[model samples]
Target: MRYHVLCGIVVSGLLFGSAHPAFAAGPVRLPSAATVSSGAAAAASVPQQLVKITDVTNIRQTPSLDAPVVKKAQPGQTYAIVETVAGPGGDWHKVVLGEDKTAYVASWVVETAENKPGKSSTGQEKPSTGGKQPEPSRTILNIIDVTNVRAEPDLESAVVAKAQPGQTYTATGTEGAWYKVSMANGKTAYIASWVVTATTLSGSAGQSAGQSAGGQVFIYHTHNRESWKNVAGSKSGSSVDDAKTNITLVGQELGRVLQQKGVPAITANDDIAGRLVLKNLSFTQSYSESRKTILEAKNTNPALSYLFDIHRDADVPRSQTTVTINGKAYARIMFVVGTGNPGYEDNAVFAETLKELLEKKYPGLSRGILVKSAHQGNGEYNQSLSPTSLLLEFGGVNNTLEENKRTAAAFADVFADYYASVQSKSK
Candidate 1:
């Protein structure tokens, strides 16, 4: 029996180091009486304390000894201290390099102003009003799907919280490239500066210094187990299915590419076929199981604006599903738009926009948009979730995984441009 392609898709840390010999020849400078007094006055006006370099040391990207040295600090050089992190070798001080930059220095090489001898009990020795005024706090806008909030301003530090896209946090200060943010739990955590944009929050108007746009894009697989001929090792038939090697990998690749292009995306890897078996449902009910997954994702993240149900086509010849672009083989893609939903026109237009973008960039890489009705497989494909929803078939069963991945990257390239254009218009 020639198995036809089912559109609804059945399927399926580092340590710290010690000072080096090169710095040993130089005379180490400790905080003098005048320096201590100046540091004390500076500390009173700033939210963070100041630390003086006690020895010639290297400032590192992280709190570990093996971390890359970002700068060389000489003795007597003073930096405002963001916080102290305990490393494997010893405690490391996170210090501010500039307005939005920070670095780490060994605790053994730096001395805090408060640690000086003859420190007053009531802190009366320091003049409070004469120091530089503190800068106004800014708001942090997370542009990624999820980012780790570390206990310290280092990647090796423990993750204390998770920041989500479209969410804003109060940025208290900055260390190197890390933002010291006040978390919801009344505790402060550090988020990498690369994943977020710091903006000044204007009073009452709720306006940020930068543009706050780009909603979350959700990608999931309905037929999660759909596999290719070479990877699944199937001897015959039109399609293959595997639990481990499947279409979900393509979805993940697409999500990764989107993230690299600055678009916030989340890829869902729920086992739809396995869930159906456990629920005693048939393969035809794959969309039903995947719908639950979509709804759950939507409930978890209301910022999700673009929804995608990724699948692999079957029963098509290898020649039809594969294409050569720039001397590299890539699995051709198809956009399947279901007309069963009330707002499917919007979905169709969305799919058409993507298809046009894809074809313009990589000609013959797209098989065009396939309009389907209720009679043609599961017509809705859970696209009613959003007007921008789409069902994408990223190659056929006859194609290889590598081809699918290449096509995923190509599609992400097109989609990212399209997404940016849309976001620009919305502004």
Candidate 2:
């Protein structure tokens, strides 16, 4: 079977759930008319244009896919065009949703009406005023206590100010994962984007709190396209994969839950499978591909202390991979530690710690730890990259997304407790 072949050499088993934590949800309020009337009047001179969403896509806080999603837009939805901006993945249309509210949608996913398509008009729509056109203003709400405001975007830069929880600042621009804000002295300061929730003054509101800041933990997926049987479509096989709905969503949920618990985390959603196809590499080299992503994240944020490669187990019996606690169903979790690496023992201990924690908080949710040797599979599973790294199998392919997400929340709950305990001990 494809399942056995695809997942072979990776199974070394150890055994290791919670109520879903409440997530912050609501629409970001639109800016007052007085705050943006001047810019709106300037935009009036340009002919009104609109774009219809061609596919279901997220309207993000910023142009980047990594930016928090403000809301989901459906097909046939139309919005007034604001301006086009060049972003990370592709060109994006900044569309006005309300009198003073705007959000970004990928240009490729929307069809423009009464305008030339596929051509970027970034500078053409600027107000006729000799001065620069007004950029979207943003309010950064500090979610953590006592985060530093730096003179530059790098962490090594000198700290110029300090921000307290609930404090808000006006952001002028973004440089990487840092936000540049105007300080009281009329000079600008940089703040780590992960430490605060940002609401664009003219754009839609994002998560009111619990925004991802590159924290101590990094979550990613080596097999990002793995999907459940229900969502994977009519493909008749043990292995199911999808481009849009996949294990990456589980990683994202884990990151969000970690953030909500005050443990800052970043989740990587790189298409490793697609990369393999492009490079003409086989499935066995999945770890080799994901390692590049992990290295980039570690280089960008040296503070990353824990690395988790999330995945789903091959076709296993649904009964074996699920459990009910407090009347809610959740996918069971298993930790796989590779004994091929020199520091494999440390990874095993870390996995054990998490399993024990889960047993205490959400009993029967963890299947226990499994150890694999070099002969068993890849045997390394990239655990050598970090002593704290482990390959986490969230559930089997038969499990549902809702079950996997519940497992993520439960894991995040215990992980936050574990993180707090570790921090306390270090102090």
Query: What TM-score do all the candidates reach, one by one?
Result: 0.58, 0.56
Q: Per-residue lDDT for 168 in model 2?
A: 49
Candidate 2 residues lying further than 4 Å off, grouped into runs, are 1-215, 234-237
Tell me the tens digit of each residue's lDDT in model 2 across 300-349. Answer: 34556689999999888989899999999899999999989999999999
Per-residue alpha-carbon lDDT of model 1 for 227-262, expressed as tens digits?
987778443565488888999999988887776666
RMSD of each candidate relative to the true structure: 15.4, 18.1
Give the residue spans of candidate 1 off by over 4 A.
Answer: 1-214, 233-239
Prediction 1 TM-score vs. true: 0.58
